[model samples]
Target: MNFEAAKTLCRSFPGVTEDTKWGNDIVFSVGDKMFAVTNLGEATGMSFKVEDERFLELTDRPGIIPAPYLARAKWVYVEDAKALGDAEAAELLRRSYELVFGKLTKKLQREIGGA
Candidate 1:
């Protein structure tokens, strides 16, 4: 997928917001916690949070690796977005968004719902 596609998919979820940061990276966040970010020059690649098990499994595949600086935090980088397929990428993004969103306060969760 590309930037627009990624952005579109990411924003489809509740409480998602987008902004460009870190010079050229576009970050998607929920309640001030980032779930994904643009990487590998523009939108050719992406980094997002994943389960520890999936992080190890995904990085074993081509075009994926541990994210720079955030590897220890269980973020995985997709070197070539196409390698991830559209459906799976969307699922992963949704999962990441949910994971971060789940950490929000109960009041914040209610706010997100009302958003």
Candidate 2:
């Protein structure tokens, strides 16, 4: 998927907020915790949290790698937007949102109507 499509998919999730961080990266967060990030200048790469079990499996694929700086937290970077189909991209993004959301405090989840 392209950057716009990825941005739109992230925005569709409940309680997601988008902001520019680190000068050029676009971050998507739920309850103040980031779930996804993409570069502003190019669609060269995008990063999102993945299930711990899937991290190694995903990184083994071409065009995908363990995210720099955040790899220990089980984030994966897609080096090529076209590496994944639209449906798969959407699913991974949604899962990223869910993973982050699940970690938020219950009170915050209630405030976001995400509990």
Candidate 3:
């Protein structure tokens, strides 16, 4: 997908906020934990977290690859957006957001929900 579409998808997740963390990277997070990021200048690839088993399965797919430095942390890169349709990409991003959101402490969740 194009950069704007990617950004929009990232922001569609609940409690997700976008910020420019690393120089050119746009990061999407729930609280302070990142779930996805992309280079602002080039839409070369996007990074998103996945469970270990799923990460392995995805990276083994033809057009997917391990994220550069974060591969060991179970992040995967979608080399070409067309490999997975928009719906699939949205699902992957949603799952990544949920994975990070699910890890938040109960207190944090309540705070985020304005408890």
Per-model TM-score versus the true fold: 0.91, 0.93, 0.87
Q: What is the C-alpha local distance difference test score of candidate 2?
A: 0.89
Q: What C-alpha lDDT do the candidate models reach, one value each? A: 0.86, 0.89, 0.83
Clashing pairs in 1: none
What local lDDT does model 1 show for residue 97?
Answer: 93
Instruction: Show the lowest summed lDDT stretch of 10 residues, model 2.
Output: 37-46
Of the candidates shown, which would achieve the greatest TM-score relative to the real structure? 2
Off by over 4 Å in 1: 39-42
lDDT of 1 by residue, 32-71 (tens): 8999998434467889999878989999898899999999
Residue 24 displacement in candidate 3 (angstroms): 0.8
For residues 1-115, could you state the per-residue lDDT of candidate 3 as single tens digits? 4545777888876677888976898899997999998887667778899988898888988778999999999999888776667777788888898889889998888777772
Candidate 3 residue 104 C-alpha distance from true site, Å: 1.0
Error of 1 at 47 (Å): 0.5
Write the residue-wise lDDT of candidate 2 on 61-86 in tens digits. Answer: 88898999999999999987767787
lDDT of 1 at 78: 90
TM-score of 1: 0.91
lDDT, candidate 1, equals: 0.86
